[model samples]
Target: MEATVASLVEHGWAGTTTTAVAQRAGVSRGAQLHHYPTRAELVIAAVQYIGAARIAEIREQATDLPTGPARTAAVLDMLARVCTGPLFHAALELWTAARTDPDVRAAVVPLEAVIGRESHRLTVELLGADESRPGVREAVQQTLDLIRGLGLADLLTDDGARRRALLADWARHLDARLGS
Candidate 1:
């Protein structure tokens, strides 16, 4: 799965073949086929594996940050790292492939649900409030709203200064809101 995702990230789903994953993983093609009979199955499994690992990392990082501000900063930092990471790039590639690939899209649903729940939880926690709170919910929404645009921009644009500014502003906003 790790080999599959890395290949997907480096070379979009259209380019990533099971044989390549097998070669990268140093596993036999027969073994790879034994695990996944179809491209869709492999894509789905790769995505799930990547999402699980990313989520685990986030949860672990949050464990040490009980304070709202620190947690907020940490979450944002994690988001930045994820956006820049190969996993996210792979996911993005899969998303594009999902349009024509029914199986790929189906696999994405569960992963997206997990991400949504976690995003909400992280937002509420770092904001020192629950989603039930008016501004708290909005702040959480805003944080993600910004990420949606920024994620795409980060990939398409090469303006490092702008990206840095956005990240800095994001950190500042959370820092002020949490006031740790």
Candidate 2:
């Protein structure tokens, strides 16, 4: 699964094949085929696997988030890091493929819905966001969208310094909006 994600991040959807994953995984073609017989199955399963793993990692890290004023910035920073990692890159490859491929779209839509829901729930929890309050839910969703947009921008260039600046400013605005 790690090799599959690595392939997606390095070579993208067009180059991630069962054979390539097999070779990268240091497994025989027969073994790779036995586990996942087709490219769609392999890539989809790899994304699912890594997505779950990364979410679990984020959940664990959330425990260490600072209390009080700094927590909002910390949560934003952590979520941004999640959006910038290998899982997000691998998922981006799948998303691009899904744009023109119906079968891939069918698979990716549901997968992303689940991931998106979990991410929103996690973010709300991390920031102690009161979604019951008017506009608070939209604020959380907007924050996720903003980070995702930043992640998309990162695919074309290394904009870490700029991204950090933007996110830091966003954190302040968000904290004020949320009354955090």
Candidate 3:
């Protein structure tokens, strides 16, 4: 799966093949086909493997934080740490695949929905509420958009400060909007 995913990432989905993945994985093409049978199956498995890895990372980062703003900060900060590498790369490749391929889009959409729900769940938990106020969605979008934008920026730039500022700013915004 790692070899398949890396190959698909380096070469687009259309360029990757079972034979190629087998070659990269040092396995027989027959074995690869036996396992995956089709490109769509392989792509779906690759996405799932990547998403599970990401979820584990999120769980690890959130393990130490108390629920509320601290937990939210921790989650966002961890995302900041990974946004430039695998996370960003995965997002780019999958989203690009999604644009042209319905099978890929269908595979990715549910995973995205899961992440979206998880984000909202974390936000609600952080705010100590069952539901976010109207501002919560906007705050999340702004933060996610900023993180995505900055992921490609200079690595030497102050990401910690930037993430911290965003977290603080989002908290204030949510608090003001929620009247809490």
Candidate 4:
């Protein structure tokens, strides 16, 4: 799975073949074929595998953060990191490929939905915000959307400075609204 994600990020979805993944993983081609009979299946499994690892990492990182305004910043930082990270890039590659390939789209959409829900749940938990308040969920969703857009910009060029400025501005607004 690690090899698969690395391949996807390094080479786009078109280059992420089962043969390439097996070679990178140092596994026999036969073994790779036995495990994943089709490219769609392999890609789907890799997506799910990486998604699980990412969710676990997010939960683990959130565990140690002190709850307060600090936690809010930490959570935002974590989300930003995820947006700009290799996993997200690999997922983007998959999404782009899925657009033209019905088989890939069928496998990716449900997994993407699951990951999206999990991300939202993680953000809400880490934010420790009062969900009872109106607009809280919408605010979080908007923050996510902003981060995703920034991350996409990063794919084209270095946008760290801009992303940081935007994040800082959003953090202040979120702090005021969410009260932490």
Query: How many Å off is the CA of 167 in candidate 3?
Result: 5.6
Q: Rank the candidates by lDDT, best first.
A: 2, 4, 1, 3
Model 3's TM-score against the true structure: 0.70
Candidate 1 lDDT by residue in tens digits, 1-180: 778777887777777988788899999988888988887788778878877876666566566555534556566666666666676687788778877878888998778888878867865665565555445567767777776666777786664577667767787875555443
Clashes in predicted model 2: 0
TM-score of 4: 0.93
lDDT per residue for candidate 4 within 1-180, as digits (tens), equals 999989988998889888889999999989998999888789779878877877777787677777655666677888888778887898888889889999888887988798889988888877877778988989989988988888899997889888887888888899888866
Most accurate candidate by lDDT: 2
User: Candidate 4 at residue 48, lDDT?
Assistant: 84
Worst 10 residues of 3 by lDDT: 123-132
lDDT of model 3, residue 8: 61
Native-vs-model 1 lDDT? Answer: 0.72
Candidate with more favorable, higher TM-score: 1 or 3: 1
Better of 1 and 4 by TM-score: 4
Residue lDDT tens for model 2, 1-180: 989889988999889878888999999998988988887787678768866876886898798899989999899888888888887888888888889988778778887788888989999999899888888898999999999999888877897999999989999999878876
Q: Which stretches of candidate 3 lie over 4 Å from their true place?
A: 8-15, 65-73, 126-134, 152-180
Model 3 C-alpha lDDT per residue in residues 51-118, reported as the tens digit of each score: 77666665666556665545455655665665666555665677788988899999999988887677
lDDT of 4 at 158: 87
lDDT of 1 at 116: 76
